[model samples]
Target chain A: MEYIFHITILISIYGILALAQNLVMGSAGLLTIAGAAFYGIGAYTAAILATAFGFNIFTTLIIAPIVAGLIALGIGISFARFRDDYFLLATLGFLMIFNTVVRNWENVTGGSFGIAGIPKPHIFSLTFDTPFSFLVLALIVLFIVIGICYFISRSSFGRVLNAIREDEDALKIFGYKTSTYKLMVFVIGAMLSSLGGVLLASYITFIDANLFTVNESILLWAMIILGGIAKNRGALLGALLLITIPEALRFFGFPNEIAGLMRQCIYGLLLVFLMLYRPKGILGQYKL
Target chain B: MKNILETKELIKSFGGVHAVDHLSVNIQEGQITGLVGPNGSGKTTLINLLSGFSLHDGGSVFFGGAERKKITPWENQIYNITRTFQQIKLFDQMSVLDNILVIITERNPFLALFERHSKYHISQAEDILKQVDLFEKRFHNAGELSYGQKKLLEIGRVLAMDTKIILFDEPFAGLFPEIIKKIENIIKALKQEGKTIVLVEHNMNIIRNLCDHLIVMDAGKLLAEGHPEKVLTERVVLEAYLGE
Candidate 1:
């Protein structure tokens, strides 16, 4: 029962990551690699606040995503002018810078040893101490986030984002500010990624820079890409399948090292194949 | 009547090669002014400067008695000046209806997301679509349309803007005869509604039929400007075309 609970939590966390990545890659047509950086910021903020500052888990949850969002806003303004490959490079640079900050910030972040012993979330008398109880909590948050994402995707602003992806100049002629919309999506994506980080930190009761490394960022992308992009359900499905693949491989007699490498290889191959054969993905309505 | 748009000594150069060299013209309100030039002539460049698509190195654009120092594309929308690209610029992935509807709202950062377009806006879009005879294909994606239909849809989008001035940059290029007639009627209707229009075209018959006045440019310089009949007969105008 605890194992099922943990798997469910894993799915919801990754589902958030996948959806956030989709906002940049799919919705806004930006190829960003800074998801893990924001994720790390989220984890650190929540961890430090909850542990050293003696703040409530709920307060840290609110504070963490906001910090991540502000960080995204700063970098996004500088990089938003860049289109296509340049934007990708800018985001990758941000990701590297963020990872370096986490690795080198020994005093605050606890260095490579990481921060642990994070208390479980509490709502008055109710405490999420066990994996099962936390799973239920994560699932509820996941539903609310997914609903907001859905509302955003179907909204008029969502249509404009999709339109800008198709032809940005067209949006401009109609008096739309394309850059403003792009920046909004970038920051929102960062907030979502950071929220995913907070969940992960609370679930494992640990925070480490290694967990939010570039590899994990790419893994997040893989999950979003595999599930298909631009569609909410596809993002959810992609996260579940990609997250489960490695564990399922372990059960089939593959060693951990080979399993990890193969998962990445399959993900790379799938991304390339999808770009060539079906750029739209399974549930995506628009083709880039 | 006072000129709605005027370019003073407008100059644009590409790598030291002048595309529109010291050329000037006035776009009057409620008139269909036709611009004719041979291939490589500065017709499109002139339109680009006027519409704020490209910057002019040395020039002043006056609209509503106010001189604009620099014309940015976004400013064009605010001033109600819209243009159809030489190549159609409709959102190819959007449905034909959305191509027109996307522009009808306040494109504010947050409002763009949640603001539902007014019913009147949709009705206006439908009317514009009907004017272009594309009402039936409103639900179809723009990329799926024929080339000429794409041209019509772009014009329809501009129509939906309710702009006072409209510029058609070679809108009839490669269009079928029937499509051309439909576009002609639409332009004629716009003219009847007292809106200003500037058209760039290569077809002499269409220009002669539709243009109220004719202006000619050759190698970035104004060759002649007058009534179409008189301008076409000018020795300088004929020489510019023949020389090219």
Candidate 2:
């Protein structure tokens, strides 16, 4: 039961990340790969604040996303002119820069060793210290993220975002400042992904630079692609399946030494088959 | 008739070649003005300049009798000027209704995030779809429409903007005669509603049947301008543009 709760907590955290990413990648047609960078920013922010200043989880939660959002605003403005592959490349560069900073900034980020002794979330008398309780907190955050994605997907703002994906120049001709919309969604997605980071840091009660690498960003992308892009349920479904699949591989009795390698092989093969047969994803309405 | 849009010595160039060279033209209010020229004659470039899709290299544009220094496509729409592309450009992935809704919905991003499409907005979009005879395909993706239907949807989008001056670049190109007739009626209706129109086309029959005023160009310069019948009969226009 504890193990099940652990898996569920991880799924919920990733579910938040995937939904936020869908706003940029699916709705706006921006192929950003810097999700993990924002996630790291949030995690590091929460870790440092809670440890150094003895701030509570509630305070860190609010501050972390704001920190990530401000950074995203700067990046979005600087990279506003890039489109398609260039945008993707720019985001990948940002991810590398972030990774370098966290790994090398010894005093603040603790270099490669990273911060430790992070506290679990608590609200006055209540504490989310156990796996089940943490799972409950993660689920609540995931639901809030889901609600935001759903609201944006149904509004007029979402209509413009869909139009931006389809044809940005056409939308501009109709009097939309496409750049502003792009920047807004980028910041919003960053802030939400940061929320996921905060939860991960607090739940693990430890922090390390290795946890928020570019590979983790790629995993988030795979979740959205495998589950479906643009659909909220698809994002959640993706988070659920991708998290469970590797764990399920553990039960197959593969050699412990080759288990990690075999998991990678299976993941690669599944994605290949998905791309070949279901290019739009399992429930996707739009193709990248 | 008053000039709704006037360009004074407008110039746009690409590398060494001039696409619109010191071109000056007038668009009369509440009239259909045809821009007829051969290929490479800068008709579309001129439309691009007027609609703020491209910037001028030199000279000034006057809208509502006020000289404008700078403009963007969105700013132009806010100034009550809009356009349709020669190639149909709709939100292909969106529903036909959404193509219109996007234009008619809130312009404010914050308000738009929380506000659902009001009854008036949906009804307005429905009216536009009905106008273009695409009401049956309201829920269909814009990309799934036939070429003629796409053209009509583009026009429907223009109508949804509710702008005063509209520039159309080869709207009748690659369209069937029946679709052409539908577009002609829509343009005529727009004119009747007091909208100023500038049309670019290669079809002489369309120019003769629909245009109240005409401007002819050759090599980025105005060759002739006046009543359609008068300009079409000019010896220079016939020899240079009509191949007579």
Candidate 3:
């Protein structure tokens, strides 16, 4: 039961990351890499608020998304001026900058060692310290996030984002401010990513700059690309499958070093082949 | 009549080559003005500058008698100024009905998140589709439409904007005669509604029939301007088109 709960919590956390990545890359058509930055920001925000200010975990959870959202909004505004590969490059720069800031800001973020002793959320006298209890919290948050994403996907705003992907020029002539819409999605996606970070920190009771590294950002993108770029089912499926791959391989009894190497090779092959053959991803609406 | 849009020495260049060089023009309200030029004559470049696609290097553009510089394509829609692309720009993945409905529906981001296409928005979309004779293909994906149909869908998309000034950049290109007639009627209806229409078309027959005033451009400069008959007959215009 504890093991099952652990898997559930991990899936829910990464599932949110994948969904947020989908909104920017899939919906808004902005190929950005600043996602991990926001995620880390949320984790650190929650950690600092809970530890230093002695705030309630629930309040920290709520405040963390807002802090991450402001950072995303600022970066999105500057990045909106660029397009194509340039925009992607700008976001990559932002991710690196965020990581560096988190690392060097030892006083606030606890530096490279990261903030530890993040207390679990409590309901009256009940503490959600165990994996089983955390799983319940994670699953509830997952449903709420998924519900919100599902609603947005079917809404008129979703159509605009899709339309932007189809033809931004067309959306503009149709009296839509495509850039503003893109920025909004960027911030929202960032907030969602950070919410995942908040849960991740709470679940593990620790977080560091390494947790939100650029490699993790790429991993989130890979999950979205593999699952299906634009579809909701795709995000969830991608998160589950990608997260379980290494564990599933563990049954072979290979050494950790060889397993890690094989995992990297598999990820590389999947990404390359997916791009070359199935650009639309497993469940994408549009073909690559 | 007061000029609705006027350009004062508007200039734009591409890699040191002047595209719209010292171009000064005025578009009066409620008139269909034709902008004609051979390839690279800066007809589209002028449109780009006016629509805020390309920034002007110098000069000012006054819309409704206010000086505004470097407007965004989306913000220009709020000023009741909208344009169609030379390449038909429709949401290809979306149905033709959605292509039009996305325009007329609430553009607010928050509202967009909560609201699906309301029945009223769909009805309005269908009305525009019917006007363009595309009601039968309303459910078809816009990309599946033929070149002519795509052009018409783009026109339908713009019509939903209900703008005061509509710029058609090469609207007649790649269109069949029947589609051309359909568009001509749509432009006519827009004109009848007292909307300012600026057309950059090569088809002289349509220009002669539809354009109340015409401006000829050649080599990024204004060649001539007047009624289509007068401007088409100008020796300089003839020379610009059919050079010795």
| TM-score leaderboard ranking | 2, 1, 3
Model 2 sits at a Cα RMSD from the real structure of 1.4
Taking the candidates in order, what DockQ does each have? 0.64, 0.78, 0.65
* Highest lDDT scorer: 2
Show the colliding residue pairs in model 3.
Answer: none
lDDT of 2 by residue, B50-72 (tens): 87788889988999889887767
In model 2, which runs have C-alpha deviations exceeding 4 angstroms? none
Candidate 1 local accuracy as lDDT?
Answer: 0.84
- All models, RMSD in angstroms: 1.8, 1.4, 2.1
TM-score of 3: 0.94
Return the TM-score for each candidate structure: 0.96, 0.97, 0.94
| lDDT of candidate 1 over B88-205, digit per residue (tens) | 7778877898888877666776876676667887798898888888999999999999999999998888888889999899999998899999899989999999899999999989
What lDDT score goes with residue A117 in model 3? Answer: 91
Interface RMSD of each: 1.7, 1.0, 1.5
Q: List the residue pairs that clash in candidate 2.
A: none
Off by over 4 Å in 3: none
Q: lDDT by residue for model 3 over A169-223, one digit each (tens)?
A: 7677556788889988998898888889888888788999988887788888788
| Candidate 3 residue-wise lDDT at B221 | 92
| Candidate 2, residue B154: how far the Cα is off, in Å | 0.5
- List the lowest-lDDT window of 10 residues for candidate 2 chain B: B69-78
Question: Could you tally the backbone clashes for each prediction?
Answer: 2, 0, 0
